[model samples]
Target chain A: MDNQTKIHIKNLNLHIGKQQILKDINVQIPKNKITVILGPSGCGKTTLLKSLNRLTDIYPDIKVEGSIEIDGQDILKVKKRDVTDIRKKMGLLSQRPYPLPMSIYKNITYGLKISGRRRKRFLNKRVEHYLKQASLWDEVKDRLKDPASALSIGQQQRLCLARGLAVDPEIILADEPTSALDPVSSQAIEEKFVELKERYTIVMVTHVLRQARRIADHVVFMYLGEVVEQGSAEEVFGNPKEERTKAYLRGAFN
Target chain B: MKRFFKINRKIRNTFHKRWMLLSLIVVIAMPIVLGVGLYLKSAMLLEQTSLIKLLFSKEWKPMQGLFGLWPFIVSSLWVTILALLIAGPICLLAAIYMTQYTKKYFLRMMHPVIDILAGIPSVVYGVWGVIFVVPLVSNHLAPFFNTQSSGYSILTGAIVLAVMIIPFILNILIEVFRNIPDQLTEASLSLGATHWETVKHVLVRKAFPGIVSAFGLGISRAFGETIAVLMVVGNVTQIPKGIFQPGYPLPALIANNYGEMLSIPLYDSALMLSALVLFVVVLLFNFASRMAIIKLERHT
Candidate 1:
């Protein structure tokens, strides 16, 4: 394992029901870098992202083979008691924003309260910190008491990001975080993703190639449950690579 | 002129936009219209007792000139509360298990069983309660209280009603739990909360309105259920001292006497009055629940 490697997938395979979904996947997600997984929909980008934190284990009858490790601690071997601990170290933003049917302030501090921080001032500061980090603090600072759902779609997504950041996780897994947003909203989220990469390691799954170009430091291109190409974003996007990757970049299948 | 037909087009398009609004207004107002109409007709038939007597009437034996209904009214409330007490936890937990913990096959298996139970006639539930439940409680539960027998007791009716309404609670809760987006549950669980904690804090909280409505629906169904209560309730029309005591509900009392009303307007009026009482209770329950939901909805 490289010293900079935070998550390593070795010979990983997954099957949902009778269909083999992820096949022989091997990747090492680097620390403090924006690594974007780009692929067509249903090509297992989200599944691979979920496998890092063992979120996919919530489903029954899915067969997973090989090993996934975070900080060289094999996540699959982690017991049920430690799942939360492992999950706490990583935060996931779904494709759609679900900002908890709670007040915006409460939404940001949700992860803290259940972790047993009952102090008033500390929780308040943490809420303000993350909300600002996601760039939604200014827009929503006055309406902190209002329901998070009252915000516009873009604001809701940012609030979800703020909520994710509240836990102080080392890695943030974003599954198509901006796919559901308009271009302006998408750009807003993209800039935040770039800004946060200095402090937090981000593994993002996106269907849009342009999104990968705009934000990713490194890119992992997947097709049919296999990694076709992966490199620094500049190299992967600029230089020649696998035929399938080139075809995909050309908008051959959309 | 071309402009003339375009004005007709504009009118037609405007009507299309308003159609759903019109439909919503009509659907929402239909029940109020029906209820108000029934109330007016019943008001014409029922002689107004003073407010106190109307509410506190005891010993509702119209045949013998005792036309107070406080006993049956209290009995109905008690039985509905009891059914909720017994069925609420079981149905909700079972619904939780079905919705969250278990797989599709298990849910597929359990759902139809609940549907079949829900579909079973009230009479069948009564027969089953009398044959099996009454015996089980008398043999297993009564001895704990040092009672000789609680045959056809309040406990028996409550148990029967609970069983009858189990599917109702479970079915509606199943729908409510299912109505929540899967992402909601996943979001909570991925936050590192345990499955139980997610259910308590997220799933149940989000579905509170739906669950409460389901409960209100259950209470209304149990309150209005007659044949099942009549068969197993010991047919004693008085306020039950406790779970082990015998009791009768208003619906059961009405069902028992509905066939025997011959000529007297008071007898027919009393039955109509009781039916009107049942209608009023149901209407108030629904309206109050709707108001409560709206108030809570405003806060949410």
Candidate 2:
């Protein structure tokens, strides 16, 4: 219940069909900081990220147990209407950018318009504001009316980031958001996350150890669907208390 | 050894090339053969009355040797347009529901039923239309609208055509909707848009070209459907005054007159001309629809 804690997870468990995906998870994500969930592939990092926003609800026969309290509301117990409201409060940057089959400008404004911001001037201003925030304004300012899919993969991902931010979410859930991009685009996103940490809570999932090291303020190192270590990035990376954490940091089983 | 292998390859290549040429000629020649025959048969009619007069004039008395195609042309177009108006929205809604909203198990069950509906013979549709739809229109709809009570009319025919084409349209639209990548919907849903809103704004916009092609396919089917339409659309030759009145479409005219065409002077030629006209119109419609789909795709 600390004012600094944005999300408090307690005894979270997720099962898809007969297989357990996330086992007895518990963590605290702080406000205005980047929390990186670092693990090897298939270690449930992405599932953990998705769990925060209830995106895992789309999977069939999936059961989620325990509480994920965001802003004093246990999202698991909220009604469907309130779940949507909660989802709106969290921005999700997927691994691949899906630009809503619309013009670049419309992609940013769609969420704003749906939330009932209809003034032409307001929409125009926010479109510029968010695109700049995602660091894609200069590259795409001339093509605001063009189809978003026409952009390069890097630009598309940036556009998606701007789109997510347009909704004015308190938290940004990114699941390996730069895994599909080239290194340069990857660096651009990493820089954007570093700058955005002062304004919004960011929970990112990544299999790449280097990325986790580059941008993690808080680190949760997971293995085999269980959290092995959770602490400040410096403590976990510089001087790990757990032997498993030490092994993972040393690239024992990447 | 290399020369022997080379000769073997040459023999195989020559055989393949000859077979390809023969099949290609057969495919290309069939349509031309049919078109040529149709043109020759209609030549007599062209000689009897100018092509413009045949196409444009409304008057039609075979005994008096005046045959204008305005009535048949008008009836054919109106019936097809009406059928599309009724079927297009229903097919689109059903397709969207099946692809976007329905459970996987339910969609699996519904798909075969839709396919069977598409596979049903058109004659069966005509009979069903007569038994069920004609009465519904005459007993209920006619009384409700205060229109004429005849069970057979342009409206009745259109209703039958609409029923027959809905399944056809739905099948195409369902395929189009299914091809939309999962990431797009996930993005929309994650952004907090409702399922309906996602479908309306994202899925529909992405699938616009395919939807256009689906409608085009549906309209083309409705336009050319022969046996069932002939049975339902009351075959009077004058232009229909309203939906309740009997009308004569070109297919019904050709179907009713083709058998006795040889006995009547210029009748064979007129019937053949109508067939040719239907072919040309349907071809143009399909071609135009393809162009529209391409334009929309490029714009997106």
Candidate 3:
């Protein structure tokens, strides 16, 4: 109920068929700051991020029991017709960038067009604005008409970021967005996230502790589908309260 | 011991390589062998009449040795094109619905149905057309449209042919749609696009080359389908002016007249010429579609 909280999760449990994926998770994502969910692989970090925007509904036989409230509205309770509206308020960057099968210009304009922004002049301006926001304008401004797949992997990821930003979302949910990028691209993305957090709430998931330490303002450490510890970066990393958090930071387990 | 094993492995590798090379040679030689055989068999008719006269002239009197193939060629084109027009949209939409909108169990249920449809004999489809489609067209459709004719016509032939190829085209289309990666769909959906919009903008767009290739394969199959179309298309050797009118396609001509062709001089060769035409057209179509697919792949 804090004024600074952008998202509030209460008793969130998710199950796929007979196995539990996320169990009784209660957390608060703050406004205008980066909240990094740090965990080992297969610990449901990606699943938890997917749940924030109701992307979990895409899979069959996924049973979700909980309330995920964003700005005091329970997103999990929204009707199917209104789910797109909820999703529109959040931008998602997946593990690997998947550009739409289209030109670079069209990929950026796709979300705008779907949301009924069809003025050609306005769309042209927004495409440039988003590409610049993702730090890819200078390299790609000349070849906006080229197919997105023709770009290098680093440029494609930046294009995906620009495409996501073009939707004008309040929160950006990135699930290991730089895992597939080279170090240069990864640093470029990390710098963009740091700059972007000034205006947008970012909830990122990565198993790389170094990344979390570099940019995370708040850290949530998860182990085996449970949130073992969560606090500001200084509290969790500088002086850990939980034995598991200490063990993990000491390179005891991956 | 290791040296002895190495020598044995080298001999085995050579033997396997030669075996595979022999199979590859046979694969490459099949169409060439068939093309040569067909050309030799049909060369007699080619020698008797000019190719232009045989292809363009509408005269069909076998007694006088006049055998123009214009009517049969036009009829075949009409039937194949009409069938494609009818089945293309239906198959594409059904495939989209099955893959994108429906549940996994629903698609599972449809698999056996499609297999059964594909497995049924063409004769059965022909019989079904005679019993059902012919009457439906002759009684309800033609009368409603103010066309007065027997049910046996180009329209009936097309209807039957469309039904026969639905499974063939649908199977390929489903595979095409399925091959599109899930990440693309997720990217679109996360952008706040509806499922239908995502399918339209992403899935269908990505599957375009595959869809074109599937349609090309379907066209080749429909063009050569003999019994099903032969039964419904009234086998009159004339250019069909409209769908309601009866027309004779080339496959029907070859299949129906092949038994009696031996009695007439050059008659057997004429039928063989029709077979050659079918083979060449299909080969050319497959080649053209493969080129289109490759070009599109590069562009995308």
**Winner by lDDT:** 3
Candidate 2: tens digits of C-alpha lDDT, residues B1-300: 999999999999999999999999999999789888999989988986899899989988877777899899999988999999999999899988887765567778988999899899999999998898888888998889888657788898999999999998998998999898777887887788877788889899999999899888888888888888888788888889888778899988888878874666787788889898988888788999999999999877
TM-score of each: 0.91, 0.92, 0.94
User: Least accurate stretch of 10 residues (summed lDDT) in model 1 chain B?
Assistant: B42-51
lDDT of 1 at A203: 97
Tens-digit lDDT track of model 2 for A164-252: 99999999999899999999999999999999999999999988899999899999999999999998999999989989888988899
A94-144 in candidate 3: lDDT tens per residue? 899999999999999999999999999999999999999999999999999
Q: Per-residue error at B205 for model 3, in Å? A: 0.7
**Best-matching candidate per TM-score:** 3
Give per-residue CA lDDT, model 1, range B131-231, as digits (tens).
99888878988887887566787788889999999998899999889888877776776677777778888788788887888888888888999999888
Best by DockQ: 3
Give stretches of model 2 more than 4 Å off. Answer: A15-20, A57-63, A223-228, A238-254, B1-6
lDDT of 2 at A43: 89
Docking class of 3: medium
Model 1 Cα lDDT, one tens digit per residue, A1-254: 77988888899999988899999999878889999999899899988988888877667757789999889889888887878888888888999998787788888777888898879999889988888888888898899999877898899888888888788789999999887898999899888888888898999999988878888888899999999888888888898379988998899865
TM-score of chain A of each: 0.96, 0.97, 0.99
RMSD (Å) per prediction: 4.3, 2.5, 2.2
